[model samples]
Target: MSERTAQLSVRDGRWTLYVALMGVPVSQWPEHHFGAGVVPTPSERSRALTGLGFVFTDGATWAWEEYPEQPDDDTSPVRLLASIRVRSRDGSWS
Candidate 1:
């Protein structure tokens, strides 16, 4: 099994590295969640995760948590990414 790495850009204008396992189908990627707080855009998140050795498939599953306390029209400013499943390209769960 071979590992893949990608260069990711951070807000500081620096490059970072990420790794991932190849051959894993997008449909088989595991699910992930974000803690309460602001999160980066999908592209940024993907790149960052990829830099960390995680693979993200395009059109992967995603979900948002809704706050019932807020009005239906108003969405929570604290956007969280609930369904970004990623794994190592080397085929290791760890």
Candidate 2:
């Protein structure tokens, strides 16, 4: 599958990455919590997941996450993604 990345600006207000799978937010999905990357990295995807888990991507309307078993969220690898619109901090697409 092709993966896309988007950077969001929280200058207006803090944002959250909302992944809509099957027309429903992944967070709202059963046992699904977004992952954040904490150890600062060059990768936008890594940066987001490093610390800010589940935060929305820039201008992202929908996102994608791999919940271990596709639907088996309880014991899944719920990674973060930018689906709808992947933008960057400088108002550009990543």
Candidate 3:
């Protein structure tokens, strides 16, 4: 088991959370949230990610509280882009 850094970005007005191992994308969540304020519950998102061996490397509190402000249009600003760390189920780092 190995771990690596992951990124969360906004693309095409959607949230995309992804991790790559050995330069290959291993896990990705393209629709982490339907909208800024419409984000899933922390437990719900965590449960979905845990299956991929990803636990929010940031504090749990932050994960729950930190969210990107929704873009009102294509030219709107993106305020919630972030990079996070992820480890394998066995607690190893890549």
Best by TM-score: 3
lDDT of 2 by residue, 1-94 (tens): 2223333222123334332334555455222233343412235444453343333344545334433435645766444433443323342222
**Every model's TM-score:** 0.38, 0.22, 0.46
> How do the candidates rank by lDDT, highest first?
3, 1, 2
Off by over 4 Å in 1: 1-38, 57-59, 67-81
Give the Cα-based TM-score of candidate 2 against the true structure.
0.22
Model 2 weakest 10-residue run by lDDT: 2-11
Off by over 4 Å in 2: 1-12, 23-44, 47-94
lDDT of each model, Cα atoms only? 0.44, 0.36, 0.52
Expressed as tens digits, the lDDT of each residue in 1-94 for candidate 3 is 4546555555566655555566544543322443544444546555645665667654533331234355446555546545555666656434
lDDT of 2 at 87: 26
Give the per-residue lDDT of model 1 (tens digit) for 1-94: 3333332222233332233235667444442333333454667667556554577544554454434334564653432213445556455555
- Model 1 error, position 31 (Å): 14
| Collision count of model 2 | 14
Candidate 3, clashing residue pairs? none
